[model samples]
Structure formats: structure tokens, C-alpha cells
Target: MQSSSKLFPVTLISAELRGDLSEDVYRLKPGNSPDASVELALTRLGRADRETTRGVPVVLIPGSFSNRRFWYSPKSIGLGPYLARAGYDVWIAEMRGHGLSPRNQRYKHNKVSDYVRYDLPAIADFIHEQNPQPVHWMGHSLGGIILAGALGGHYLQQTRVASVVLFGSQVSRIYWPLKVPPVEWGSRLLLKSFSVISGPRLKRGPEDEPIGLALESLRWHGLLGRFGDADKDWWAGLIDVQVPVMAVAAEGDHQDPAWACRKLMEQFGSPLREFLCLGKKQGFSSDFGHVEMLVSKQAQLEVWPLVEQWVRKSPEVAAQLAMQPDRDEASAVSADQA
Candidate 1:
């Protein structure tokens, strides 16, 4: 078992300041089989104060091929800790076939349907069984696609979720074009070849890394940056979502264009919606890229405040937290009984 001290190094920028908050490993029951199981490696940082626990719990799902550890590093452009410091109870998740969770007989391969049918539902069930309160869901890139698909299906109705937030995610299967044609074709061929040769190579990390499966999920969406049929039906399913939602994009992310993010928001057609384009002019930047908003140094100053303010403003979430057992008080009660 990896201790929290070993899982997160102290030299990492955020850890240098905040230290290790709390960490735990969860064994998730398989939705499809009684004998099958999945593991979630989760870490929480920030206050254990009553006010912090009272705030809405934000479940952070990483993009495809990415793992929970991506958010832990000081150099991460991911958003796990920023939200934690800003007072949200942050939970970073690792999809099967990535990081600590590897494939088993039950989870044989990485498939889009597997994510929709098993991964999302499993996380929702785990959250409800343990916390028993509505949680706010946030996903990035392919993670966003999975969440969108799950919400459109029966999963949303079955889960006790409060709201949804998507960052740099798209509903359409077709992706925006790049400049060079050969570059585009070459990139596609490389990803396809990698997917075939790399069977479950996703377990490797930044130091001992393998080619990512994120491109596979994009391919599943038909967003390979080449011309293809638009996934309008899949896109249309998002219209069925009833909960409050906030869609965000980094101005610099070419992968998920600012225009596409705006278009997705327009599709929501709800009064309880907000969209933010971070950075100066909605274009690429040196510091902030597709994944930088969460882990970048700028996140503490620029992005977290907006998310913090928005979460605090939601009366439904605030009320939910107010009603839950206080973390410290609950701990004390348990201690006294012991």
C-alpha cells in the first residue's frame, strides 16, 4: 500500500505549501458482475474545517489516458488541488486501464461503451454509498464526454448528483481542423498504431509513460480532426439535462475551440448556465494550454476564484452541505464512542 506521504512528494509546489491533507483508497463494486471490482485511488487536500466540508463536493474526473496522479504534481495543469484550497471537497478519479486501476477479466479492454456503462455508473454509485449526499461532477476533455453521455442516459436519474461542470469538452464527434493536412493524417495514423500496439500501456506514468488512450476516446467520438459524420444525436442528448451546469474553456485550448464551447452552452438552453473563457483573448498561451488551468501557477490567482464564487452562490449545494454531518464533529463522536 502506498502511503499518502509516498504517493505525493513534498517538493511538489502545492504540497510545499499545503502539506498532505488526507488520502484513501476505495474499492468500487462492479455494476455488471458480483465478483468483479474496480479500485479508485483518491487524495484530498485543504481544510477539514466545518465550512469546507459544508461546501459542495466536486468530483474531478481526468481526461482520457490521464490518471489521478496528474492532478497531484506541482507542475500539473490540472484542477484537483486548486478547488480543494478554494474550499470544495475534491475527489480525483482514475478510469480503469489507467494509473493504479488496470484491466481484469471483467474489464478486458478500453471501450467507449465501457466508460458509459460501467465507469461513470460505478463512480456515481460509490459516491452515493459513501457520502450519501449529492455531489457536483466535473470532467475534462474525454472525461467530459463520458459525463455528458452518462447524464443523458439513465445514470443521471439514478444518481444523487447536484450539478455538472465541463471543461474543454465537446459534444460533436467532428473536431475542428488543424493547419497542415499531412500533419493531421500522420497524427491519426500514429494514434491508431499506438492504440493497437499499446495494449493496456496506460498503467505507465509521467516518468515511465506510455502513449495515451485519450486519442482513442476522441476517435470513438469521431473527433480525429478530420472530416466525418457529426455526432449530432449524441450531442442532442445533452439537451435532456435538467440540473444547473457551468461550461469552461481555456482561451488557449485549440483541441476544444472557444466557439465549440460556446455552441455547447447555447445548446443547454437553460437560465442556470454560465460560460467562462480564461486568458487574454481566447487563444493559445505559453502557460495555459488544454490541461494547464488546474495545475498551473496562474490557477490559484485566475481560475479558482471563479469556480469558488460560482459554487458558493448555489443555494441548493450550500443547503445540502449544511445538512451533512460535520467532519470534525463526526470524527469526535466516533472517537468518544471508541
Candidate 2:
């Protein structure tokens, strides 16, 4: 209900072309509930070729303490560019207080709840308004968790979603100590005293995460904790979601294991869902880790091509009535780069 605020206005900050690809940046101001002063940034990558018709849009969301750079590097050589080069419209989202998005008034107290309720829907609405097609969302780690929360809670519009791809993401990570009441409360107390978690200091990533995010996790893994908010049961809602999904986990990923990732995917009700685990057994050259599953040289030669196919061929709605398939959506996606 809180996310149902009036549609926010989007501002085009920059648009440029390099070689044959166009890179456009937009800033959206929600100016609505929970926090009205937050600014969300989206960096869109597509072809600058006027004669080339753009394909379906693919939105990439990064994990905790990370930014748009996860899918895009300053050298223009990540998944975003790869997708763009293949004629797919690519948008990398930088969450509140990260990358191009400046810290908001509620920066210190931000939680995943805020992201699921306020931020993602606005971004989804804006993307749908422009692309006018169900988006294929891909997320890594915390990014994937946010997407799962949005879908399970029914916060983001179902009609705007064509498919979802999650890499190394799961909410089922066990925290045995947090199940104890006193320990949980005490940890919460200590975390409340801090304003934010430093990413660089902990060597997790580049950006600092708000303390509220950690505190929120405590509530989730605490004894008898559920994934929903005040009024809805998100876990139960996942059983009703009909959108197709692809969930990938790595055998070397200790943070979110393949079995746990499978557990998460199994919760979805989509008839056309897939679960993939990357390892030598699965024909991958190596067992990929959490980050390596998406951002490694090995993945470049193997995983990236599969991802492009996942986006291109299927994921159409069952009825195929709401949208027209993207014309000239993809060319051959090259995976030769190391």
C-alpha cells in the first residue's frame, strides 16, 4: 500500500555513445512515502545504431555493499555491455546511497523493506513505461533477495515481470546463534548503535550498507521469523507467483549454497522454472564461487552465453497477450572474451 504512491518523475542526466553502443543515465526521485527524498539511479546500455531495433530490456541488480559497477565496469566490459552489444536493452540499478544515487535523508536507517516497498516498484514502473514489456530481471546476492521479496510479497507488479534470474542468492542462510532470544536481542541492540556497515573496511565490496539492513536480517533469521512484513506472508505468496524463473548457484559458493538456492527456487509456483549448479560435474571448467559465478573468466566462456539465451528465447507469458515480442531482440552473443 505504501508503494502505491503517485508515479515518480524520471530525469535524464546523461546519454552518450561509444563505438556503437549508447549509454544513458537517468535519475528518478520517488518524492513519496517512507522516504520522499531518495534518488534512484539507472544506467541504461543499448545500441546507438539508429537502424538497429532494440530488443527486450534486461535489468541487472547488484548485491549488498555493491553498485552498478558489478554489471558494468569503467572500461565498458561487463554483462551490461555484453547484453547491449547483442541488441538487448540493459539497465543497471544502483540502489539508494550507492553508485550514482546519492545518500537519502533516511540513509542511515535504510532496510531491505524500504527497497522492496518503495524503490524497486518505482524502478519497475519506470522501466515498463519506457520499454513497455515485461522485464527480465537478473540479480546477484542481496539484489536477488530483494527481487524475491518483491515478488513473494506481491509488491512489484506481476504483469511487468516476464522472468527472473537469480545468481548466488538465498534467504535461507542459517544463523544458529540468532535463534536464541537473548542473543538476538543483544545483537540487535549493538547493531542499533551503529549507523552503517563499512564495505571496504570489511572487504565485502566498495559501498557501505546501512545498519538497518543487518538489523533487519536479524529479525528474519531469529527464532520463528517469517519473510513477510506486517500484513502479508511472502513465503506463502511465492506459491502463487506464476512467472518463470531461473536460479543458478555454484558448487563453490559457501555463502549461499546450491541446495539452498534450489530450496528458494522450489518455493516458486512457476511451471517453467530451472535450477542450475555450476561445477565440473555440470560441465563448467571450475566450480564457481559467489562472485565468480557471474563475474569470472570461466563464467565469461560458459555462463554468459547461457544467460543470453535464457533472456532471448523463452520467458514469454503463458497467454502472450499482454506484450509484443521484441523485434530483432538479439544477435549472436559472444562469450569468447576473458
Candidate 3:
């Protein structure tokens, strides 16, 4: 099952036709983190017609307490499929023990540091090997934060990332109580007592999160705490991140407010970065919440097109957009051309 392609070993778990699009799921067992023994599941969506030219590759990472279904459902109805239908080769990554990726030995001990240090880089390498073009990365919530961690820690080279679009992703949200040592330390102690945070039980999402993630967050939001590990200050390191970035926030999102999301976007040193807030004032039909920002029906009409626009924001795609303001380049643009 080991792929003959260069780099680390990759196991193609399944490859079959799902409706009109072909679905190929690969499991990557990273050799570096032998202690964790985590196997990441990556689901790729592409055109059913193999002869058709493929477009740029886009990787979608879901947030905490979620799975690959966040981007793609069992019915093959989600943004992932939509993007594939539009000629883009789309990949949905399930981190650690989430979704199709089974629980590992250190499931409960998984943290963003692990993802940034090992998983993200592995995914990047595999995708680049599959398609020599630079990949576009899009993350939601914790997924976006993890991408930032990878970039800030210098784990993921900016040159490999074509552009980044983050939906409801930010790390600068302030917890007033977390500023207190007693509260931060006490909270960490309480969280450490549990193995995982139940998403459905807490009405957070569909997947459970490891307690280690909460502990890591506490340290980041703790008194005078920064967004890096023992070796580097990721928060400050973002100042050197030159990747093209965009952060999307929703006004109705009480969990991660717009201001805080904007604050996180401001951390990036990319000159080609933008902050978008979804609300009535911004001409959006409705004020999107954290989850609704990307999932709901409103997003289908208003945001999905915008996402497609951003995905095709490269030199060729931009030229196409400029020429045909009314026509969509999604179906017209070919992989070799765009």
C-alpha cells in the first residue's frame, strides 16, 4: 500500500467514484512522530472524467471538534465537492483521530504543536509531490490556527503555500479571566483531568478534542504567554510570514468575535492580506455566525462564489476574472492553464 512517490510513505486506503466526482482517500503515517503513532486521513476530490484538465490544488482543514465532513459530507454535498466540480483538485484533511483517521496511541495527548511540527508539513509534502504546483490552503477556526502555527514556526515554507483563506479562524481572542494566573493555571489543571473535550455533549461541534489542545490554549492565553512553543515565539514569528492571507469573520459569531478575528489577521506580515467581516453593514444578506460563516445556505449564495473567486485569484485566474466579469472561470480554467 506504500506509495512509490518520493518523500514519506503514503498508503492509499480507497479510491472510487463518488457520484460524478472521484474520491481518493489516503492515510499518511508520519515516521517522525513514532511516539504518537498518528495516521492522518486525507480525502481528495476530483473530476470523474480523468481526461479533463485539473485546476489548482486546494487543501481544506476543519476546525476543532470537527471532521472531514465539515468540508465534505457522506452525501458528497459540501464545499469540497463544489470546488471539485469547479475543476479544482480539492483535498480534505482530518487531523489526528478525527473523521476517517482513527484514534492514535496519543489521541488524548494531541496538540497543535504536533500538527504544526509534523502533520501539516507531511500533508504539504505529499500534496506538492502529487501536483508540482503550489497549493492553496484554507482552514476554519482551530484548523486555521494550526496553519498559522505551521507558518509561524517555520515548519511550512511560505513558498509552498500559494494563498491562504481562513474562515472563522483567529488566535487573538482575549479571555479576561485567562489573564489571571490562578484562573489560567486552575483551568489547565481542570482540563488536564479529562482525556478529551466532547464536542456534541458540549454542543461545540461533531468531533471531540484532545485535552492537550485546551492546555496549549491556556498557555497561549495565559499571563504574558505568547503563541509559540519552547523554541520560538509564533506570535512574533507571524510578523515574518509573507504568505498571501485573508481572514473571514462573522458579526453574529459570539464565540470568536470579528474584532478578535481581525486582530489575528493583523498579525500576519503579508502585504497581500485582507480582513473580511460578514454582516449587514458589509452587504452580506445576514450576519453569519462562526459555523454559518462557511456552512449555512446563506454562504452558498453569497460566500461560496467569493471563495471560488479567491481560489482563482492568481495571475491567470485574475486575468480571466478581469476579462469575463460575468462568466465564472471555475469551469473554464484548466489545470495546466490556471
lDDT scores in order? 0.56, 0.83, 0.83
What is the Cα root-mean-square deviation between model 1 and the actual structure? Answer: 11.6
Candidate 1 minimal-lDDT segment of 10 residues: 329-338
| Segments in model 1 whose C-alpha atoms lie over 4 Å from true places | 1-20, 31-55, 74-78, 106-108, 173-233, 282-287, 315-338
CA displacement after TM-score superposition, residue 268 of candidate 1 (Å): 3.0
lDDT of 1 by residue, 240-305 (tens): 665666777776777787567666655653335667777665432433567776656676567767
Q: Tell how far residue 122 is off in model 2, in angstroms.
A: 0.3
- Stretches of candidate 3 above 4 Å error? 34-36, 314-338
- Output the worst ten-in-a-row residue range by lDDT, candidate 2: 329-338
In what order do the candidates fall by TM-score, top score first? 3, 2, 1
Off by over 4 Å in 2: 1-6, 50-52, 316-338
